[model samples]
Target chain A: MDILVFALCLAIGIAAGYRNWLPPYLTSRSSWGLTAAVYLLLFLIGCELGSYRSVLEQMSGLGVQAAALCLGGLLGSALLCRIVGGGGGV
Target chain B: MFDPKPILVLLAGVILGAMGHLPEGFDDLIGPLLRGALILLFLAIGFDMGKEPRLWETLRSLSGRALMMPVAALLGSVAGGILTGITVGLPVGLAASASAGCGYYSITMILLKEAAGIEAATIGFVANLAREVLTILAMPLFVRYFGKAGALGAAGATAMDTALPFIIRSAGKEVAVHAFVSGVILSLIIPLSVPLIYRLLS
Candidate 1:
């Protein structure tokens, strides 16, 4: 269901863009709609996290473990991809 | 591209919520409002990708090596989690599944809730959100040192939407396409793989 809803929105938008369905004013980046949408999502995500009081409380106790997991995963990804990917840089 | 403005806005929202400033019954509204906003964001991102003048030309040029990006990302995350989980004395399954969320917090939490319980779900939520924030903040360094796949792999599902600005800024528009592709692939697969691995390991 999560994938379905996400893909449906993306497909609709792609079709609209491909077919020039949205008005130029909206489709153009000048409207800053995209920026607004992104910022809104980020803000909402923060709100969602903050609303979960237990999660917030647990953060203090479990944060070190979480950070360790994050770093390990990140480093493993970088190392493996670096070895195999030839460091395809910008 | 490394805009601190969005991060600041996020922190402001967090402070407001933490302070209970959102008024009574706002909690119920947050989920729906966030969904609406996310839909809009996804649409905008898709439209931008679709309207790129060289979209097809770029897609056509994708190499076999580029296709391997998500694989490396998936395995690397699992390997890292297993090792870290052992070092930390946590369940390997628990840590691996959480890290495999690939920064997609909402879905990862849901998956953990079903597969494990609320406690495990909470851990998954935090771990994955950290991955997202870290990717947003440090994508440039990941790209500079570890290469495009390093950043994209670390970004996981966010390589498409949440992490795109950083990836594009650090790696360029061409590699951003690869980021989008790998992100889409990981997004699709993570939902499936996370659960299976958890069930197997547990």
Candidate 2:
């Protein structure tokens, strides 16, 4: 059931892409759509965080380990880019 | 005017969480919302792809760079997983799964829930979500310093849909196309790769 829903959503996205409906939003001089989307997502994130307040506290209690994982992910990605010579124009 | 979808879905999640909803029911709603969000995001990416006139030229110019992006991403995933496992003392597989999870936060969360239970899934989801935020904030610096290939590696599969407009804005149409193709390829691998990594490490 979940897979079916995922496939359906992906199909819709592909359809939208092939049909060319996103450029106007991207190139719009006014930031209406973009701002709305960003803000909405941000608010959603905030709400989720708020709901997970206890979990956040618990995770933070885990201390340096959690922080290390986050930093490691970032540094690892950056290092990989440098090593692979990915630091050039596409 | 504010777009309602993100807000609505978020509100729904919050309300449910506040109400102390169980994982099974929340899972049902989250699946649909995530799928809906991805569809909308992907559609926008497709539209952006349509506007690129320099796609062919860019592809021609960066063929070599394009090939390197995924290799970089794969390396990043492995390195991240290893480092995290060492630091957190979690199983290397779980760490690796988290590292390779990309920006598919909801999907990763869903997978973690099914495989490891709700608590583990939530942690993975938050970590993945943080990764997305970091990707959005840091993408420009990467593009400036490393160029399109760097940015593509940094963005991973997110380059296709969520990050498509930014790539278009930062590097132009050709780069965006390259990123989009790379993103699609990465997304295909993530679902299988994350699970495999977890299984192997465990």
Best by DockQ: 1
- Candidate 1 recovers a fraction of native contacts equal to 0.55
Full-model lDDT for every candidate: 0.74, 0.58
Per-residue lDDT of B178 in model 1: 80
Candidate 1 clashing pairs, residues 3+ apart or interchain: none
Q: Please, what are the lDDT tens digits per residue for candidate 1 over residues A1-90?
A: 254565677778778877888878777772387778756766665666667687678776577777777878777777777776777642
Interface RMSD list for the candidates: 4.8, 6.0
What is the C-alpha lDDT profile of model 1 across B1-202, one tens digit per residue? 3336765776787788788787788767866776676567667766775676576565567787777887788789878977886787668888889888877776566556556755676677678778888998998899877888688888888887889988888888888778887887676567666767787787
Cα lDDT of model 2 by residue, B55-158, tens digit: 53554565676666665776686687578757677666666676676665655654554445444555556566666667777778877876666677777767
**Docking level for model 1:** acceptable
For model 2, the superposed segments whose C-alpha errors exceed 4 Å read A1-59, A62-68, B1-11, B21-68
Clashing residue pairs found in predicted model 2? A17-B46, A87-B146
Is model 2 an incorrect, acceptable, medium or high docking prediction? acceptable
* Candidate 2 chain B worst ten-residue window by lDDT: B41-50
Off by over 4 Å in 1: A86-90, B82-202
